[model samples]
Target: MSASTPHRPVRADAERNVARILEAAKVVLAEDPTASLERIADEAGLARATVHRRFASRKALLEALVAQLNEQYLRALHEAKVDSAPPLIALHRVTELVMEIKFSHRLVMDVVTAGTPARWSYLSAEVRERAELLFARLHASGAITAAHPSWCLKIYLAILDEVHHLPAGAPELASCADEVTARTTLQVTTVLGALGGAPLPH
Candidate 1:
């Protein structure tokens, strides 16, 4: 930590190379689950040896990508400020954001949900606790009518799991970006309304 000590610098070329490899792997993996490491390296304009040096292996690359995505999700949750919003609105907004992420990265979400060994299955406990707290507030406020507050968690997971794996040709629902979101929202809203002590506002 002395001022006289030399500070080690990461070479700009190496930094760029790592960034390129991550970007290329994301694109290639979306299109082809079994995308070759060599092709990914070529796509990133790096040699196979360099890609290996950066990622070590395909599994390492995927795990890194998943970690990056988790960070993004955490940032989004923070920005949404769900805790400050009204309970029901907060729940809806959180669900909407989750759906948005799923739609944008359908392939990656699917791969992870399908028990991909390299990816983590759920968000960090802090995120989950925030969500559960929102649901508990909603339950207490009579925004939703669940005999047991834990039922909200069950419904939330069901919606997320179903929407994440929606088929390519599903029928469209109203007021949604696509058939998947629309139908999912409709089904989830209905269930929430039933469990929610009060009727949904028009």
Candidate 2:
């Protein structure tokens, strides 16, 4: 076998290692955005040398983490089927999924913003479409008398932002079924009230 051929597998293995490190970086940094590379390496079960070889500096690591955050978030939006459910159900389910995502991925909630990388813009557009579908359904059913769809969309998103805020630190709601249930109730109740939608059956 050619000597060059053997080196190919080594490179492939190195790439896989980098991916693992970045995923671990997501978890570590979400809990503490300033976490050290050594801590991240520990999270990845990798040597510091392996992580440094992939990311030369903290800035490089953070940039990679942002990209990873956007990718995972967009994927979660797809998995949530934000546009496929009935109007009210879509609002509740999408809110639930987004809460789960925000709670699970601290990096995503921390880094995603108005000026996030251009590639992530489509995710926001899809979310707005979800809002439009929901409000449209409410209008059709005579459930809301919102005269301006744009205003209603703004209110919907604003409520979502407040409900999912993580001011102290990244959320730890992933494992608590009772907390998720309570938050889901709060989310549905507040958003529905804000949008003038009728109360759903308990």
Candidate 3:
């Protein structure tokens, strides 16, 4: 078997089955972390055995889902290209993008929050480094004024935490998640502005 060859092209039915499984898992897991694999298979309209065949185990399925969501989120961030935009606008855009992803894939956010520190430690080095670089560039350009470089990370994590664990059944909050996100963005920018950073032109 070669790397280029999957031994064979996946059959259409199997492809559909896998896609359905992933989609169903995403929906159920986002709503409830304790959702069972059997429930996921049922939602996918597939046999439990079929789900197992594709995912091997529950852990494998969850890991695959998290990885998929992470990749998509990263792609969105890259497309946003905050570094190329004005510092305050970049912050707002990036924050909005992250909150959108978190809302859509709440399971990933839950897993990261619930997991041991070691599980998420890997993100700090790679993802945090890039974020810090973006913040540092903005600070250098007078887009944000922070006496300490670590403030950027603190602010980013705070916003992410609030968005990720939004209260349930609060239609008021749910309805205003977008507005809340926007307001939060502006508030952060204002604080940064107070630090002597100039706002980017709208």
Candidate 4:
């Protein structure tokens, strides 16, 4: 067989542009999944031709967003130190981290989850495994007593799914830092309570 060509590294400016486009796409598409490439280009402050040259089509751009979401979830899990932190602390940290991502990328998440379910299923399975392991730790630590680890994990994930369905652009919730903090606090409390854990102090 002939040798396969090695992929070239992206130039720094090109890499920066890609990052810019992806961030802009997240913001714009979260507000409107039907947003156009020109709209995204405007949001990114780049030439329309630049975005078209980078993504080629809306479907191609959504694919890139899905890939970005996958990396982000993995990073969040790593940063949460789910494997090492105390179970309650780890649970609180991961829930908060995931909430930030899901809130910012709601519509993009909905579109991709509906159109490309398999992409998220792969990530979900890994996240589920890690989360269930955390729940097992919680159970061992006596934070959860009434349910199995798998069951607790299901409840936690369900809460996250429900949070994803909340209003992404509601000004009262979006613009107020206290509201966001309260929402996350409620989410953690609900998960802990539903999983039979004592609530952490505010």
Among these predictions, the greatest TM-score belongs to 1
lDDT per residue as tens, model 4, 1-202: 2333333334667888999999898888888878998999999999999999999998888778877887777788888888899878887888778888876676567766667644346355676677778888888888878557777866776776765556655542445555456557667887777877787845
- Model 1 lDDT tens row, 70-189: 766666566656678776666666666766666667665644434454233456666666767777787778777664645676676765665556555555345545654575566557
Q: Kindly report which residue stretches of model 1 are placed more than 4 angstroms away from their true locations once superposed.
A: 1-16, 116-120, 147-151, 167-172, 175-184, 197-202
User: How many pairs collide in each candidate, listed in order?
Assistant: 6, 0, 0, 0
Output the number of the lDDT-best candidate: 4
Compose the digit string of candidate 3's lDDT tens values, residues 1-202.
5975773566777877888998998787777778888989998989999998988878888777656666765665576675676656666676677666766665545653455453344253446655676688778887766755567666656655654454653442433535556544554554465456676566
What is the Cα root-mean-square deviation between model 3 and the actual structure?
A: 4.6
* TM-score of each prediction: 0.75, 0.63, 0.71, 0.71
The local lDDT score (0 to 100) that residue 47 gets in candidate 1 is: 87
CA RMSD, predictions in order: 3.8, 5.9, 4.6, 5.3
Please tell me which model should have the higher TM-score, number 1 or number 4. Answer: 1
- Order of models, best TM-score first: 1, 4, 3, 2
Sliding window of 10 residues with minimal summed lDDT for model 1: 112-121
lDDT of 3 at 187: 46
What's the lDDT for all of these models?
A: 0.67, 0.67, 0.66, 0.76
Clash pairs for candidate 1: 144-196, 144-197, 145-195, 145-196, 145-197, 172-179
> Which parts of model 4 have CA positions greater than 4 angstroms off?
1-10, 47-49, 106-109, 116-125, 146-151, 163-177
Model 3 residue 39 lDDT score: 89
